[model samples]
Target chain A: MTAYSATVTVRLKEGVLDPEAETTQRALERLGFELDSLSSADQFEIELDADSEERARERVTEMTERLLANPTLHDYEVSLQQR
Target chain B: MTAYSATVTVRLKEGVLDPEAETTQRALERLGFELDSLSSADQFEIELDADSEERARERVTEMTERLLANPTLHDYEVSLQQR
Candidate 1:
C-alpha cells in the first residue's frame, strides 16, 4: 500500500441556517467590517495508506458518507494525493 | 468599493489536543482504515465590499486576529478575491 493524504471538506447545504456563521457575521459587522454573507464549513485532513490516488479519494469519500458528514445537512468534497 | 470574497481557515495549533479529530480518527480505524493522523479545521467564507484585494485581506486578517481564531490554540490563513 502507498501512503496518501486526503482532505474532506463538509459544508452545510445552501439554505441551511448556520447559526455559528450568522453569529460571526454579526460580530464582524459590529466590528465595523461591511460584508454580504458568511458561511462556515468543516475541513478534515487524513493521512493513510492506499494503493492509488483514486483509491484514496474513494476511501475518503466513503468515510465522509459514513461518518464525517451528515447526509441530510452537509455536502462534502474529497481531495487526495499520493505521498 | 467593489465586491470581494474572503476565505478564512482556522486550525488548531500543533500540540493542541483535538478531541473531535481524535474521535473521528478512532471511528475510521474501527471501520478498518489504516491511517496516520487526522486533523480538523473550520473554514469561513465571507462576501464583502472592499477597495482592493489587499484591503479585504487586511480586514479578514484583523477579523481572524480579533475573533475568528483563538491565537493561543489556533492558527489561521486568509485568502481574498475580487468579485
Candidate 2:
C-alpha cells in the first residue's frame, strides 16, 4: 500500500454570513494589514493508506464530499500528495 | 506577477484537548464510521499575486506563522499551487 496525504479545504461561499471572518478582517485592519475581503475557512490533513494514487484520490474525494464537508453552504477542494 | 493559491491546515498536536474533534468523532461513529482518533482542524485558502513562486511561498509561510495560526498550540503546513 502506498501512503498518501490529503488536504481538504472548506470555505463558506460568497454572500454567506461569516462573523468569524468579519471579526478577523477587522483585526487585521487594526493590525495595519490592507485587506479586501475575508472568508471563513477550515481544512483537514488526512493520511490514507491505499493501493495507488488514483485510489487514494478517489477515496479522499468521496470522504470529503460525504463526511468532511457540508455541501449546501460550503465548497471544498481536495489535493493528494504521495508520501 | 504569478497567481498562486495557498492551502494552510492547522491542527492541534496530539494530547491536546479537542472537544470539537471528539464530538465530531462521536457523531461519525453514530453514523457508522470506524474512526480510531480525531483531531481538531482548521484551514485557509489564500490567493496570492506575487513576483515569483518562491516569493509567494515565503509570504504565505510568513502569514501563516504571524497571523493565520497560533503556533504554540497548533502546527500548520502550507502548500502553494499555481492558479
Candidate 3:
C-alpha cells in the first residue's frame, strides 16, 4: 500500500444561495475591504493508504458523496496526491 | 479598476484539535475506508474590482485576518487572480 492524500473541495451549487458567505461578504465590506461578491467552500483532506492514486481518489470521492458534501446543495471536486 | 478574485484558504493551526475532522475520519473508517489522518479547511472566494492585484490581495488579507479566519486557531493562505 502507498500513502496518499486526497483533497475534496465542496461548495454550494451554482444556483444555491449561500447566506453565510453573503454575511461574510458584508462583514468584509463593513471592515472597509472592497469586494463585489463572495463564495465559500469546505475542503477536506484525507490521508490514506492505497494500492494506487486512482484507488485513493475513488474512496475519497465516495466519502465526499456520502458524508462530506450534500449532493442536493453542493458540488465537489477531488484531487489526490501520493505521499 | 479591474475585476479580480481572491481565494482565501483557512485551516486549523497545527496542534489544535479538530473534532469535526476527527469525527468525519472515524465515519470514513466505519465505512471501511482506511486513512491515516484527516484535516479540514474553509475557502472563501471574493470577487471584486481593484486598482491592481496587489491592492486586491491586501484587502482580502485584511478580510481573512478580520472575519474569514480566526488567527488564534487558524492559519490561512491567499491566492489572487484577475478576472
Candidate 4:
C-alpha cells in the first residue's frame, strides 16, 4: 500500500453568516489594520495507507462527507499527494 | 488601489498536541474509516483594498503574526492574490 496525505478544506457556503470571520475582522481593525471582509475555514490533513491515489481520494471524500464537513453548512475541497 | 485576497493558514506547531484532530480521527474510525493520523488547521481568507501586492502581503503577515496565529504554538502561511 502507498501512503497518501489528503488536505481537506471545509468552508462555509457563500451568503452564510460567519461570526468567526467577522470577529477576526473586528479584531484586526481594532489593531489598526484595514480590510474589506474576511472568511475562515477549517482544514484537515489526513495521512493514511491506500492501494492507489484514487482509493485514497475516495476514502478521504467519504470521510469528509460523513464527518469532517456538514453538507448543509459547508463546501469542502479535497486535494491529495503522496507522502 | 486594487482588491486583494489573502489566505492565511494556521497550524499547530510540530510536537504540539491537537485534541480536536484526535477526536475527529476517532470519530472517523468509529464510522469504519481507517487512517494513520489526522491533523487540523485554520485558514482565514481576508479581502481588502491595497495599493500593491507587496502591501497586501505585509498587512496579512502582520495580521497572521498578531491575531490569526499564536506564535508560540502555531505556525502560519500567507498567500496573496488579486481579487
- Top TM-score: which candidate number? 4
Model 4, residue A13: what's the lDDT?
91
Candidate 1 residue pairs in backbone clash: none
Interface RMSD of each: 0.8, 3.5, 0.9, 0.7
Per residue, candidate 1 scores C-alpha lDDT tens digits across A1-83 of 89998889999998889998999899989998788999999999999987788788888898899899999999998988877
TM-score of each: 0.96, 0.68, 0.96, 0.97
Once superposed on the true structure, which residue ranges of model 3 sit more than 4 Å away at CA? none
DockQ of each: 0.88, 0.29, 0.88, 0.92
True contacts kept of each: 0.89, 0.15, 0.94, 0.97
Q: List model 3 lDDT by residue over A1-83, tens digit each.
A: 99998889999999898998888888778887777899999998888999888888888888889889999999999999888
Q: lDDT scores for all predictions? A: 0.90, 0.72, 0.89, 0.95
What is the per-residue lDDT of model 2 for residues A1-83, given as tens digits with 9 covering 90 to 100?
A: 87787777778776778888777667766776443444557766667678888987887677667777878888888887887
Task: Rate residue B83 of model 1 by lDDT.
Answer: 76
lDDT of 4 by residue, A1-83 (tens): 99999999999999889987898899999999999989999999999999999999999999999999999999999999999
Model 4, A81: alpha-carbon shift in Å?
Answer: 0.6
All predictions: root-mean-square deviation over Cα?
1.1, 3.9, 1.0, 0.9
lDDT of 1 by residue, B9-83 (tens): 999999999999999899989998778989999999999888888888888888889889999999999988877
Error of 4 at B58 (Å): 0.8
DockQ of 3: 0.88
Clashes of each: 0, 1, 0, 0
